[model samples]
Target chain A: MTTETLTPEDERRFLDEILRRELTPSRSIAALLAGVLVVLLCVYFLLETILALFRLPGWLIDPDEALNWVAGLPGTGPGPVLALGGAVLAMVGFFFLVSALMPGRRARHSLPHPVLAVVVDDEVVASALARRARLAANVSPAQVMVTVARAQVLVNVRPTSGLRVTDDAVERAVTEELDAMGLSPRPSVTVHLASTGVVGA
Target chain B: MNGTPRGLNRFITGLLGLLLLLLGLGILLVSLVPPVAQAWRDFAAPLVRGLHGAYEATPLPAGSSWLYVVVAVVLLSVILLTIRWIAGQGQGRASLLVERPDHSATDGEVTISGNVAEQLLRAALSGRGDLLGLHVVTYQYRGITALRVRLFPRKGASPQKLVQDVESLLEGLDLMVGHHTPVLVHLGAGTRAMFTREERVR
Candidate 1:
């Protein structure tokens, strides 16, 4: 009988590897939105065409009228109408092209590790870091704001009155904590201390 | 983490984008050039006239009420299917089966339910002072079962320490289950804490 035991190092390595695969942005939301829009438009046009075929009362759209509108474009000899239509088309095309190319949203980050894979969500990272900053600054949790980005972690500290919170101290604390996590492609840490301190317990 | 969009979705979006870009450019060019516009109009005139003529001449036959019904049913079916496809676009597999390394012909495979995994995680991690809330969900990743652990941390909790504790808990879970499963830890801010604190201070 063979049994498998994963040491802490093995677990760490596994997490590191998985993180890389799981952290990248997904295009699912964009795809779903686009798919629904296209389907609705197709259904609308198909319904209209079918209604026109049946000579229904609600079939206000005339194929002849649409065709005539297109046919009449040349008679007007390149006016604002054609330009506006072209511009609208161009805008729509640009939107689609950008959506196709743009990375939708950064929801998670893959930690750097050679053997193990691990992915952590940005929100989780932010929350965790916020707690760390709050403790280090000796400020209320609400006074600390943490933003976790792909390449950077921004910590904004609003110190309470009578508490002297230095940027270097907060920065060092955050840096050490982040370093201990052993994040791959480690993001740089930025600590900002607001000048005005909030009055709170 | 959510998986990437399906291949078909990306392809369709790319195709639509390319088509729209080309159509827009062509329209812009035609609008700018009088000669090109004239050519386009001349080319489109007969097609437009033919389409209108066809529409006028092809009214449904007087006694073909059944034909309308058939067409309506087919169209409705197509619409329904399209809607269903759209709704299911990004859904991922919910459960994963634990693979058996050595099995006789009669041995059966073990199935891991996502909800069960969530319950196990909650049972293991709940009541920790550092954690405000815990949610566990399972998703298929790269053809294998993976768990996503979303944690809302208590204010002033050390992020590094919280992560270490979570890792240890997961290790214990893996040992108990007899198979190692990938786990994703998501740390999120405690919304309730943030809002309540703000209201109190105000």
Candidate 2:
């Protein structure tokens, strides 16, 4: 309708922003952990300082004593404790660094549409592929398994004892289904038929 | 689609990581090397002494130290700020979907609540067993109101069919509203979809 007034550039920008946010994983976990940690640290110091103002002993030690202990850590603290604490801190830092650097993409793919923007999760795609493959091979749902990866789809089928199922039929059906979906960066399809068929129907 | 400050989150995480990395490595180094330990002692001794001096000199009413009051206030503010930041995540859901001001009209304004779109779409898309659940949420993106329709597809449900069905429904909404509203259709397989057994009519 009135969306026709959107220029190509505007549409592209709109889709780009939406897709960028939709595909990337949110950093809520990291933020929450960091925020909680900071809050805890601040609370500890606040309590310690308040206690020291009235000349009361801190839960662990006096505020001044705690500082002296920390200041003395690099020089006189036990070697093993320093090493362990340092290693743990370094590992935590590396974890945060990795989380920030990685794109953290979710399992999703976008489909081309004339007017509407659509994205489907890879799990959903796998389920659809499994259905198609099972129907094409004339097998029960339990006999077929589908795994959808970032760039490939694998369909495994176990034919019934008396019936014969060809890989070509399953592959063709899966490919046609994928074509109909028109997912961007279309994943390649692989069909595998088990040599040993199940006994009975 | 919701307003989450992802970039800032990443930045804060990275900064925390760098700080921790340096602190860890510094401790590890100081503990393992005599020269580093000696250097740290030399640097810290003066700072420790200076802090002690400050604590003794600064006295407020009731024998409480001004230095302690200042430190406590600073830590309290830091805790407050962090709590505020943690509470601000995942906000920005718009209740008003559309609002237009027309000076020439008697009413001079046209408004549509977000509930209208959500109800209309939900009513139109209901009774589809292929979808385990559906949610319509409105968000403000770049000063324009946009809609995100999240569909939980049952196992073995065709996403292609789902996309086409939603597109036609959106077209219906556009005709009713007399203006185009941008929409993002997301079809996902949640736990409900995973646990749903396929129903077959024999």
Candidate 3:
């Protein structure tokens, strides 16, 4: 093995690339399914063409006849079936286009580290935030809901009857937890307190 | 971590989408509009006639059509290529991690397998109830072998705490191996944690 000199900045950039690729939402399923469909289509045409070349009975239809039918499709004019099929085809195409264009990011956040690369899923952050909010607001586990998004964290709290939970308390708790975690591109925290409180303590 | 070229997948998907979009829109327009339908018919009639003329003119030794034979070959190649493309996705899992030539001996070599890191890391992290699962694998990144540790943390588990704990364990691993190996710690929510509530004290 050979040792090559790499600067600290280059090493960080390389690690960042790996982490980003790992966290990106995979499009392998879409690619695989589309490839299979294409292969099947090609197989169908190949079989028909081979049957025609061999002068045998067409498995489904002769290649020459299929070509003629496609060429004659425009002569048939607009019909409900034709219009519906066209619409469906367009929709499928549009879906694929969107999937390809979108970045398709997963709900994960990478933390800054000197040598070790670290990534944490949003669900874990949400859970931790919810737990902290529940503790700070003096509410039950079910009374607090924390939703973590790409750039924001929404913490909703339902206080017990006769117990007032301040918005500042929940906000400060969530902020403190976020500070402890030190996630990159730190998410803005939003605390929503329900007007109506739960009945039992 | 497995090697899956996401950019290539997106490109192929985009190309396929663009082709289908054009073909479908062309069909829709030609069917809905009378003028377009007439134009298409005029455009396709000559092409179809020419195709038929060529098909008839080209014949194989066995009295079969050479045009269809050519078409069959092209389609077969397309199918084979597509299958190959699909098979190439998500590969490059490394089974061996390290190899060092022993200078003291004439022909001695030292090798380390990926399973050594996997089992050691798994045993180190197995005591934590907050983690739903743990997976450690080694992959060749650039020219160096690196360890990828995937931690499936239970709901309400603090990922920061988990990361810190794993870092310490990795330090121990570094001492055992006599050198530091690059590591990536991923704290993820696996399907079990997503669908089920696993916390007991919460």
Candidate 4:
């Protein structure tokens, strides 16, 4: 049996690769709605077909009646009505097809690496930056709000009275921490110091 | 992350969408153009008459109608079941089995449960005041086993410190397991209130 051993660098690279790969969100809501609609339609058709076959009162089950309805639809009075119905059907179909084919977008940011790629979630980055900002400003976690976007990180800090908090220091600290993270396509950091301070110990 | 829609769903959606689009376009075109409308009516008359004649000729017997109803119900049930199976493609067990890298017949296979990993993580994170909650889920991606560590930090907790502690614990787990399992840490805010002041009524 041949065994392969990974060096430290190899292990680090593997870990980095694992961190880079993100799970794609499954648009279950759309799929579930579509599935439910299809099931409901099938159930309705089943009931109608069964009722009609049993010589009972049923709506829109007879093939002959359906064909007649189709044959009569073209000559139905208003041209605008027919056109509008057709347009609605076409638009619904178009949107359904597009959603079925499209993939879910990943809410992650890629970090720069020489031999390895790393991707971090936007929320995770925001939490980390918020923690840093809170520490740098010496404020409670509730006082600091961090928002991490594709190309920017916004930090809003609310300091208490008699406490001196420098926006530049907090901004520099957050920026340095982000830089140390080595995120690819690093986003610009903006720090905002709110004028009003909350009354609390 | 949830997996994308399966091939069967995509195929079904495409087929249904195309059918609807074509039918709608055909109806709109026939309604707008008089010549097309005339042509369609002329073509549909014979087909409609044939259908009507067929329906008239095939008069269902009193008791035999029940058989047809049963058949229709069964067919519809099958179709609905198929659609449900296709839609439920991604939800499966997230745990992965641990196997030795060496292709040795003498060595046996080992299975690692996600529950066990979670317990291990819980033990590692015990006594941390800043942590609100920790959850560990195992996922297999492209044949690699990964442990997704979800962390909820208490209010005012330093995320960097928490991450460092989790990283060290992961390293320790790797050493103990005799196999390297990469950890993916997801940090989020704690849902619990940090401090609740009690009202003092005189």
**How many residue pairs collide in each prediction?**
18, 0, 0, 2
How high is the lDDT of residue B28 in model 4? Answer: 83
Query: How far off is residue A198 in model 2, in Å?
Result: 1.8
CA displacement after TM-score superposition, residue B76 of candidate 3 (Å): 1.9
Mark the 10 consecutive residues where model 1 chain A has the least summed lDDT.
A110-119
Best by lDDT: 2
DockQ of each: 0.36, 0.58, 0.63, 0.32
Tell me the tens digit of each residue's lDDT in model 3 across B20-46. 887888878877887887888788989
Candidate 2 Cα outliers beyond 4 Å, as residue runs: A1-11, A74-82, B31-35, B57-64, B102-105, B199-202
What's the CA RMSD for each of the models?
6.0, 3.1, 2.3, 6.6
User: Residue-wise lDDT of candidate 2 within B102-196, one digit each (tens)?
Assistant: 56748657677778887987898788878788888887766667788999988888898888888888888878876677888999888898788
Per-residue lDDT tens digits for candidate 3, residues A1-201, read 622334667767777878887678768888997898799889888777777777888887877777887888765544666767777888778878888999888888888777888888888889878888988999888899998888899998889989988999889988998999998879999999999999986
Q: What is the lDDT of residue A51 in candidate 1?
A: 63
For model 4, residues A55-131, the per-residue Cα lDDT tens digits are 67667556446667777667667898988888877876776677667774566775543422234567667866887
The lDDT of each candidate is: 0.66, 0.83, 0.81, 0.67
What are the per-residue Cα lDDT tens digits for candidate 2 across A1-201? 001235657766786688778878879899899889889888887878888888877888887777787778664556889799998999998898889889888889888777667788998999988988988999889999998877899999999998978899999999999999888879999988999999976
Q: Scored by Cα lDDT, where does model 1 land?
A: 0.66
lDDT of 1 by residue, A79-155 (tens): 76877788788777777767777655456665543332445556666765776677789987668899878789999
Alpha-carbon runs more than 4 Å astray in model 1: A1-21, A51-58, A74-86, A104-107, A112-117, A134-144, A157-165, A193-201, B1-4, B21-36, B49-85, B95-112, B196-202
How high is the lDDT of residue B35 in model 1?
Answer: 88
